[model samples]
Target: MQDLKGKVILISGASSGIGRATAELLASKGAKIIVNFRSNEESATEVVYHIKEMGGEAIAIKADVTIKEEVNAMVEHAINSLGKIDVLVNNAAGGIRQSTFIDASEDLWEETYKLNITSVLLCSQAVLKHMIPKGKGKIINISSTAARIGGAGESIHYAATKGALNTMTIGMSRELIEHGIIVNGVAPGVVETPFHEKFAPNDDRLTRMSASIPIKRIAKPIEIAECIAFLASESSNYILGEIINVSGGR
Candidate 1:
């Protein structure tokens, strides 16, 4: 466990899935959490309630990370409420539907980039103002295996955006490391989350996807959260601009 007592961490899209798990885990390690949810207020509240029930501190804030104004307000609110933000988890992202690259519409491409790529950029920029001043911070982005393999027949746009994030992670780390801010990413494969329920839909599809992995099963949300927790901690201080693949060796 990292000594995160008094540390303030902000997690976007923290209503459920990997974001929620990361928030809870960090809270358990003594970090104060600012849970940012776009629409799922009830779920976000549950996350905060559970954290407090476990004697941890957490607060949920609503914000559409894709919008610059909203992103700015979210960061300001977190700083005002928690005094400072020591870590940022850019975990808010989604795919509309799996489609072939050529068959993908312009709207789908735009929306995918807005939520997955632009949101990360907006959130990182907003938090960098405060982190740079402190001379120490962590920015952990949630990427995907799709980025490397290319989701050609399945969510190619989504995969492209994650690839953009991967590049940004490397670029930002080099730009900010001199200021003591470490930027890294986590690429998860076939995780059991709401994302799969919405995107995959069919149980048989998920089973087949899991069977393809070397581990022969999908990952639990907590598994990915553990990796994010490590990146957010001081233990990863020497690790910068790297994306750790938690892909079950896929």
Candidate 2:
């Protein structure tokens, strides 16, 4: 759809959820994908296999995105294998359990910061080193609507980190656009993904949240993936530094 043929893309946390959807969707459009997973190689390999089975190209790599060395190594490996990365989807984030402001733990804040903020920083910097020299690249950061409403008191720490990502996205676009790299963000409201399964399953959060969303239902990962796909394409060349909200008018 975007003339993604031969475009090499790298997606972090692609073993599942939105990252996996983006990888598969991009691959389906003729883009070669590097699926980065921290530990779930089995799932990552499954994604690669699915893409190949569908006549697309894909590979899986392991990296803890929060660690600079690991992120750098993963990018190096991807560059070595693919020759070049035309796009980067900073989708690695999660492991957040909801808590209130007064009840939030120190570990919660620190871990959330690492997952949402530090990882984006590490991955972007690592990829920018290559993209800046090439004079062209697309970076789509996966943020959340929680950044605006502060998670409605569910996960303030996570929301705070995403707010930072929103800021970083704008700053990055301004600084990097001159180098031919477009940095933007996608903020999803409520999605039906493994993220909810891990963090909101106990209370059937989706059911309750659906009543509040204007769409009256939760979104699928592919819905959000579609937006990422748009930003990854040259079609969005004129659009820069903006965070597109993909929520159901929440």
Candidate 3:
């Protein structure tokens, strides 16, 4: 395990799913964790409670990451509470209420962009104000396999935003590396998370989707969390401008 004994890490949308998994995993490695949630205080507190029980330090902060003002406030709270952030995991992401491409409305597209793309922008900029000055930091963006495959016909808008994020990751990595801030991305495939339950097709379709992958099954949330942990570690110091594919041969 990477020794993150004193590192402070902030993860957005950490009340549940991949975000929650990342928080617990990073904390387990000795990093002080800031778990950011939009509206789920109870869940967020549970995450913090679990971390504390395991002898890790953590605090919960709430913010609607898509909003600039709230993003700034959340960052402020994190800095005040944790002293400094050594890593940022941009993990809060979502799409429109389930819809086929033809049925996806412009409003849905707008909301999805705000959640998936704009939030990354807002959170990154707010946190960079601190990390840039420190002259060294890590940023891990939670993209999706959908970004490369274009959704399963129902999440084109979400896919589009992730694609934009992929581009942004590369551009930002090149731009930020000079400042000693390493920016990278993780694109996860069919993970076993609530996100699939809410956004993907029915269970029968999901079973088939899983069967079709080369691994013949979906990934556990921790599998992706493990990858994020790596990017946040000193082990990845030589890597830059890379968006790793955690897909199960998708």
Candidate 4:
């Protein structure tokens, strides 16, 4: 395990799913966790409580990362409460509904971009202000395999936003690496999370999706969290601007 003692890590949308798992795993490695949740205060509290119960340090903060002002405030709170942020996990994102280009609405497109693409930009910019001064930090984005293979009939808008994010990850890394900040991303395949419950509600459909993967099984939240933790640690210092695929060979 990576020794992250004294490190301060901020994870957005950490109330549950991959974000929550990342927070828990990092806390176990001795990192001070700033759990950012938009609306699930109770779930966020539970995450912090569990971390504390394990003798780890954690605090939950509420913020809508899509808003610039809120993003700035969240970063400020992390710095003030934990001294400084050493790692930022941009895990706050959503795909409200699926629609094809022919049937997609303007509002859906706008909302998808705001949540998946704009939020990443806003959060990274806000945190970079603090990380730049220190001349060192880590930014790990949660991308998706859909970015490569367009979601097509599923969620084309969501796929487009993630594609933009994947490109931004590379661009941001090149822009920030000279300053000692490493930017990378993880593209997870079909994982068993609330995302599937919301997006693919049909059990049979989900089963077919899993069967299509080479592994023939959906990933656990902890599996993706482990990849995020690796990218956040010093072990990935030499791995700048790359997005690792945690997909089950989909």
The regions of model 2 sitting more than 4 angstroms off are 202-204
6-82 per-residue lDDT for model 2 (tens digits):
89999999999998899999999889999999889999999999999999999999999999999999999999999
Off by over 4 Å in 4: none
Clashes of each: 0, 0, 0, 0
Indicate the worst ten consecutive residues by lDDT in candidate 1.
149-158
Candidate 4 lDDT, 1-250, residue by residue in tens = 4788899999999999999999999999999999999999999999999999999999999999999999999889888888999999999888879887889999999999999988998999999998898899999999999899997347888889989999999999999998889999999988888987888889888888988899999999999999998988888789988989998999
> RMSD in angstroms, all models?
1.0, 1.2, 1.0, 0.9
Candidate 1: regions farther than 4 A off:
none
* Predicted candidate 1 versus true structure: per-residue lDDT over 1-250, tens digit per residue: 5777888999999999999999999999999999999999999999999999999999999999999999999999988988999999999999877778878899999989999989999999999999998899999999999999987347889999999999999999999999999999999998889998888888888888988899999999999999998888788888989999998998
lDDT of each: 0.92, 0.91, 0.92, 0.92
TM match of model 4 to true structure: 0.98
Clash pairs (backbone) in predicted model 1? none
Cα lDDT of model 3 by residue, 1-250, tens digit:
5778899999999999999999999999999999999888999999999999999999999899999999999999989987999999999998757777888888999999999989999999999999999899999999998998888747788899999999999999999998999999999998878788887558897888888799999999999999999999998999898999998899
Pull out the clashing pairs in model 2: none
